[model samples]
Structures are given as C-alpha cells and as structure tokens.
Target: MILTGYLHQQLAAAGVTRAFGVPGYFVMPVWHAFRKDPQIILARHEGGAAFMADGYARATGNLGVVLTTSGPGVTNTATGVASAYQDSVPMLVISGQGSPTTFGRGVFQESFLLDRSASPAALLAPITKTALEIVAPENAAFMIDTAITLALSGRRGPVHLSIPLDQQQLDIPVPPSRSASPPTVGDVPAAPCVLAAAELLRSARRPLILAGWGSMLARAQPEIARLSTQLGAVVVTSTKAVSCLPRDHPMLLGHFGPGQRSDIAQAVSSYQPDVVLVVGASLSRYYANPLAAVLENAATIRIDISAEQVGFRMRADIGIVGDAREAVSALTSAIAAGGTDTAAEPDCSAAELVSAFQKRAERAALRQKPESHGMPSVAGTISRLSRMLPPDAVVIPDAGNHWLDTISLCRAGRTGGVQLNCGVGAMGWAIGASVGMAMAAGQEGAAGRGPLTVCVTGDGSMLMHGAELTVAAEHELNLLVVVFNNRSHGRVRLGQRLDFDREPMGTDIPSIDFAQWMSAMGLRTFRIDHADQVDEVLAAALATRGTVGVEVLCHPDEVPACLRGWIED
Candidate 1:
C-alpha cells in the first residue's frame, strides 16, 4: 500500500476515527485516499474545520485531526489553531503542500518550505507545539506518529504537519507492526508534595478548592470531590473548568472569574480563606485577580500539568507538578489516611456560597417573569433554557454579550457542560464547534440521535460562520442552535459605550432576521419576541431533530455587569 493508506491505518489504529476539513486541489491525493475511510466532516471554511476538530477533541478526550489544502487553507486555520493552543486542546493539523520539485517556482498553493523565512510553518510555530513537514515518504509513519504523541502528551495542545503531494503518493514499504505508544502523561511526583498538601488542608481553619482546566483535562472530578469532602472545603472553578466538579456536587460553589457571574467573585473575595488549593488552573489575571482579597495572604497548594503555570501569578506554599488527576488523587488518599475531621462543622465558605447562589436565584426568578411583553432579558432566557434542557445536553456558548449572560446565568451540573472558548475569545467558535461535537456524539449512538447538542450564539457570530449549520443538516446530526439576536456586536457595543464613553462604531448590525436566515439553511426555525414565548419556542426546537434554530429578540442594552469588567479589566 502507498504511504497515504498506511498513514490512515496508523491514525485509525491509534483511535482517531474522525477528521474535519475542506477539500481543494492540493489535497486531492488525500481525498482519493480517504474516499471511504475514516470520514471527514466537510466544513464551510478551513477555520471552522479546525474549530470542529478542537470541539471533537474536547468532547471525546482524544486527538483531533484536521486537514486543509496549503496556502490560504493553512492561513485560514490561524484563529482556530491559536484558540486550541491557548485552551490546551489536543489537535493535529495536516496541511497539504506543493511538491518539493516546485520549491519556490511560484507554485499555485506554495505555502511553506524550509528555505522561506515567512512560510506558513513560521506563522503557525508559536501556536503549535511543533510544526514539521514530511521531507520523504519513508519518514511519513515516524512523523505522523510523533505528531500524535506530542499533541496528546503533557500540557496538551496542537501540532502541525505539512505533507507534499508527491511525498504522500510515493510508494514505500509498509512500516513494521505498530508498537503500543508510551503513556500520554508522566506519573505524579512522589509523596512529599501530596503529604504537604494533605497536611495543609487537614489543619487549616478554612480551606478552599479552586478547580480549573487542568482538572478537566485530567478527568479528576471524582478525586477533586473526594478531597473537597474530606476537608469540607468549598470549591470554585475557573471558566474553562466549570464542569470539573459536577454542578450538583454540594461543595461546588460556582466558577469565579471573567466569564462567570460577579456574585461568586464577591463571595470568594470576601470569604478570606486561610488556605487555597488550585487544581489545574493558571489563575491568570482574569481568574486570580478578581479573588485577590481571598488569596492575598493565604497559603496555597497548587497542582498543575505545567510547572510554568503552577505558580504563574501567586506563590505556592506547596506545588505539585504532574497530571491533575494523579496529583488530586494522591492528595485525596493522603487526606483520608491522615484522618479527616468528618464530624467537624462544614466550612464557613460553603454557607457563603449558598447565600450568594440564593441571591442570584431570587434575581433570576424575578427576571423570569418580566411584566411587559417586551424583549426578554438575555440572562433570564438562558436561565430558563438551562432548567429545561436535559442534564446531558452539550451546551456551547459563543463569545459575545450573550456569552457573558450564558456563562453567568446558565446553571451547571448539566454533565454535558456549558462549553465555551475562553482562550482566543473567538466570536463564532461555538457555531463551528457544535458540528464537530454533534458528529462525535452521534457516532456513539444512533446515527442522528446522540446527546442533544446546542450552541448559544450572538447574531454577529451567526453571521460569521452560520454556513456551518448546513453541515449539521447534511449529516442529520441532532443539534439545536439558539441565536441571541441583540442585533449588534453586543459585547463590543457595550464596551465602547461603557469604557470609551463614545458613540459605538461598527457595532450596530444591519437588521437581518436570523429566523429567516436559519430557515434558508434548511433548519427548523423559531422566532422569540416575548419573554413568555422562550419556553414554548425552545421546547419546540428541542423536540425537533437534525438542526433547529431559535432566534430570541433581546434588548440591545441589557447585559451582565461583568461584561463591563471584562472590557475595562
């Protein structure tokens, strides 16, 4: 068999069952090889393809693969790749390149070569863990295997490979039988770090657990819950790691940071815990800075996959450098062995959490019943939908003012999670990502009936990549997309008005009825003009199969207060 066929075998053997991309001239060789093999979900744009791959990886906890023709195709993946890099999602990008014989002869799709200083590899290097090219057909297996390994290993992120058409087509000896790959991540450090962390939580007057992305990547929710219970610690999460503790877990207060509601931030900041345990979160300015009053003088135990990010901002009283699951597991075991005070009173912070949540719930209840039949509150709309959706529905929120409302008001413990792109803050990431997630979920169940996947997006995001919705229709994937049509780049408009103290420019969107637009894409559509209509319309959309869209009319000015904090801070 040729190198292309063998490469496909290797990927499949490694459990990479799906790929996302768009076809073009330079990639015909790949298309011919993949004609009926591991399916490639066609995307409207190269950027959307990468986003789909990222979403697939996030949903399945596997390596995501994306292929694109060289030149413009390679460049178009910039936003998606960078978002994956920042969010630490494991992904592989395959860029089809021009033949070696055409080096710099101005080939039609000449994207990269070792000789060019401004090549595509150079452009993508900073965003990828590695950017390599297949120089010879014989090295194809080794190179592809290496890319997969790097993408799945510690501090997981993306890797890029550029394959020349001739190299992919050349006949080469089939590589020897595949050997089992090495462990994806290293083992936890020996018991000293664990012991110190255990002792701190065991003896502290007040202990708090802050779970974040690392814990999610580690799949250590059980371990985290165990530790929280053992120490009677109040738990909070970063925006990226909101699902780290099941939403229903008693110890879980809420996520605290830029994308989360301000009440949780106020609670954590005012609680003044004596000890802080941060799992898998970098605690960047957005997350850490908000709770400065809590962490200011507290002893911290930091566990993270990356050593560089463990004590990135605040000094750690004890730092464990390893996978979050292993580190958290070790801590839990040690705490149990040390004899936790099971009879002790619950942490004071937990009561504070209940108070904060009660206040938010009361406000949410009031907003749920707006007196006038005017536009519904964005948060109220999201809160109502959160209650209606099943516990397993995968909710993805795009970046916009609507996103702020969704993250802040959308109740957690859904298990499917309210997934968002907290990295590059890309506008339409969820729109494209929903397709990949729906496709992945569908593969695990009946073809068109998987976990109900929903994308909550703003009109601006819909305008950017709404074309990808057609892919959902083409595949008959179960999906319901909600468009919070505030009729402008809502976030930016709010920012300009609040921060700049000036008239908004280019933020106002021309009137375009998204319900009509979604219908044009062959999706069942629902238009929501009143607050009372939300439940009825959303229920109708959820009941339908394939792709369905709900366009909610929102008041342009009403947005979360934290939206202003995100802009000025």
Candidate 2:
C-alpha cells in the first residue's frame, strides 16, 4: 500500500472523516486518492478551505483537517489557520512539498528546498502548536499520530504537517500501528484548589459563573448548567460563548463583554459577584475588561486549562489549572458535600431577573430609531432573523458592524451558537465557515439531522469569498448568508469618524447587487430594503432547500447600542 492510503486509515481511526482543499500538481497523488475516497471536499481557495475546516471543528468538536499543495497554496491558508489558532480551535493542515531530490534545485514551488528561507514550517510556526516536516516516508504514520494528538491536547489549536511529494507515493509493506481513538488531555489535578474554591463559594451571598470560548472548547455546557442550578448562580458568557447557556434559561442573564446586550453590562455595573467563578476563560480584555469594576471588587476563583491564565487579568483567590469540564465537575462535587443551603434567597425570583433583563433590552431598543429613511437597522434585522430561525441553528458573523450588531442585539437559542472570528477579526472568515458548518450539521443529507447555518457579513467581506457560494450550491448546503450591503468597511469607518473625528477614507468599496450575485452563483437569493420585508424575506430564503443569500440594506450611520454613547447628530 502507498503512504497516502495509510494516511487515510490513520485519519479514519482518529475519527476525522472529512478534509478540505483545492488540488495542485505537486500533490497530484492526493487528488487521485481523494477521488477514490471522496472524503475531502473541493474548496474555492486555500483560505476558504481552512475556514471551512474550522467550522467543522467547532460544530462537532472533532479535529478538522485541510490539505494543500506547495507554494502560494500554503501562503493563502495562513490567515484562516492563524485565526483558528487564536480561537483555539483544534485543526491540522497537511501540505505537499517538493521531493527530497529537489533540495536546493530551482523548481516551481520548491523555495523551501532552494534555501530553506521561505519554508512552510517556519511560516506557520508562530500560529501552530507545532509545525513539522516529514523528511522520511517511513516516519509518516508516527508523525501523523503526533500532529493529531497535539491538536487535541491542552489549549487546543492548529498543527501543521508537510509531506514531500515522493514520500507520499512510497510503498510500505507493514501497516503502522494506530491509536484506536483521539487522545484527550487537560484534567483537573487532585489538589487543594478545588477545596479552597468550594469553601469560598459555600459562604457566598451571590455567585456567578462567567464562561468563555475556552469553556465551550472544554465541552462544559452541561456542567455549566449543572453548576448554575447547584448554586442558583447567575450565568453569563463572552461573545463567542453566547450559547454556553440557553437563551430561555432562567439563571442565564445572557453574555457580557463589549457589544453584548446592555442589560448584562448594566447588571455588571450595578451589582458585584461576591464570589466570581470564572471557568475556562483567559479573561482577555475582549470579554473581561468591560466588567473590570465588578470583578475587581469580587473574590475570584478561576478555573482554566492554562496556568498562566489561572490569574490572567486579575488575581484569583483560588486558582485551578485543569480542564474546564473536569474542574467544574470537581468543584460541584466539593460544594455539594457542604449542602445546598449556601445561597441566600434573592431579592427577586430567577424568572423576575430574566423578565427585568428583557424589559431593559426592550426599552433600550425603543430608544433608538430602528431605521433611517427606509433602511432597517442591522440590530432589527438580526433580531427578526433570530426569531424565525430554529433553536439548533448556528449563526456566524464576519468582522465589522454586523459582528458588533450580533454581539449587542442577539441571544443564542437553546442549542444554537454564535460562532465569530473574534480571535483576529478576519473580514471574510464567516462566508466559508457557514458552508463547513452546514455540512457538519449534516443538513444536506437528511431532514432534522442538524442545524442551519446563517453567516452575517458586510459587502467589503463578501467580495473576498464570493467564490465559496459556488461550493455551497454544489453541495446544496442548508445555509443562509445575510450580506449587509453597506458598501463600506463599516468598522474602519467608525474608527475614523468616532475615534479620530475624521471623515472615512479608502473605506469605500465597489457596490454590487449581492442578491443578484448570489443568484448568479446558483444559491436561492432574496433582497430586502424596508423594515417590513425582514420576516417575509427571511421566511422565503429559509424555506429554500439549498443555500440562500439575503442581502439587507442597512442604515449606514446607525450605531450599535454598545457604542450609542459616542454618537453625534
């Protein structure tokens, strides 16, 4: 059997069922192999392939895989892969390199061989947990196993493996031993930290569990729910973790952080958590800085996988370095031993707390003019779409105003999540991700199998990945892409106008009929202008079996609620 064949078996054993990439001659053998296996999907570009794999990983918590040939293919994938790394999504990228005989020879896409100056390994080193080059054919299986394990280990992120062309075609007589399943790491150590944390919580008057992207990475949703019920705790999450608790959950006060709903920010400003139990978060400024005043006054107990972040932005009274799920489980068991009488009766019921939050949100919305002339606000459209979507849908937002709007105005449903490119705020990230997510949901294969994917992006982002729509049409993916047609990089414009007090420049983008463009690309498409058309347009778009795109004309100067204070007439 050839090395490529053995590689497939290894991936299959590790439970990785799909790969994404575009084909190139340097990796021609892989193209032939893919035809026989057909486990890999063809993508429009290398970057799109990377983001697609990222979506698959987030949806299933499985290792996402992408393949590429040499040279520009490797370079094109860097930004997407790096964004995933920052978000700590588990992924592996496989690249084909020039043959060993070509070392130092001036061959196409063989710059790595010429001087080792522009090697793919060096290029991806900073973003990956580890990057490796398989120099020998016999060592391929072991290296493959190592890369997969690293990707799944502590602080889950991406890993890179490059295969030389000839090495992939090598014959092997003996089958390499494979691990039966993917490795799991990061568990709570049996230490005094758990006891110390429990003691603090046991005597607390008010407790809160603030979750983050890391919490979801640890698959601690059920544990979060259990702990909230265990302590009558108010639950909040970061932007990426909006669905860590269900929208309708009584104890769920919604997420906190920049651009999150005003009620959560108000809650953080008014009252403090006597004992703040932060789980799986690094307390990056993106989520933690906004709640600085409230947290600084609280006695904190943070549980995270990284020791460096156990006391990230502020000092923790008791810090535990472990897996989020394991730590939460351990802490729950410890707190339970003391009894359930720890929490005092609140001033209001859980239902009342939720109700008050809703009322505040309603009042806040009413304060703002929801439309300018005929253009609907991005906030209004997002809310309308959320109401019409199923509870299991996944909503992805690209970088810019639409991203902020989703964070500020929306609440995730019972099983759905808001997946964002907040790691680096890549502009066109969500377009391809929506395709990958829909496929992972198995929405195309059968009814009721998985959630629909909705990608909310801006026009500046749309042009970057218009080609991905073709891939979606080919798969007939259960997806809806809502392109906010503002014809500018809205975030950059905000910075220029609000921060610098200067008129926007170079932020303008060529306008295109997004609905027409999507229609031309084979997706069912709709165009919306008036506020009244939102629900009806969304219904028509969602009703289509395949991929759909809804282009919404949004008010250019309508500021998101989070930034409402800085507005000028």
Q: What's the TM-score of every candidate structure?
A: 0.93, 0.93
Clash pairs detected, candidate 1 = none
Which digits, one per residue and each the tens of the lDDT, describe model 2 over residues 27-125? 777656755332888999999999999988888898888899888888999988998899999999989888878867867877373465378888899
For model 1, residues 1-569, the per-residue Cα lDDT tens digits are 67778667666766777888998887778766765546688889999999999999988888888988888888899999999999999998988888888877777866645445246678789999999888887677778778888899888999998888888888766555543442355666568888988887877766889988878877787888887877778888888876676566776777876556546666666666789998888888777677777777799888988788777887888999998888888888787787745434446657567556655554653454431236776767777787788778888999987777677666665543778789899988999888888887764244348678889998999889899898887787788899988778878887888889988888888888999988988888998888778788878877877788899888778756355332222
Q: Which ranges in model 2 have alpha carbons more than 4 Å from their true place? A: 35-38, 113-117, 172-179, 341-351, 362-370, 446-449, 565-569
- Report the error of model 1 at residue 142, Å: 1.5
Alpha carbon lDDT of each predicted model: 0.79, 0.79
Top candidate, metric TM-score: 2
What C-alpha lDDT does candidate 2 achieve relative to the native structure?
0.79
How does candidate 1 fare on TM-score? 0.93
- Which lDDT value does model 1 have at 126? 97
lDDT of 1: 0.79
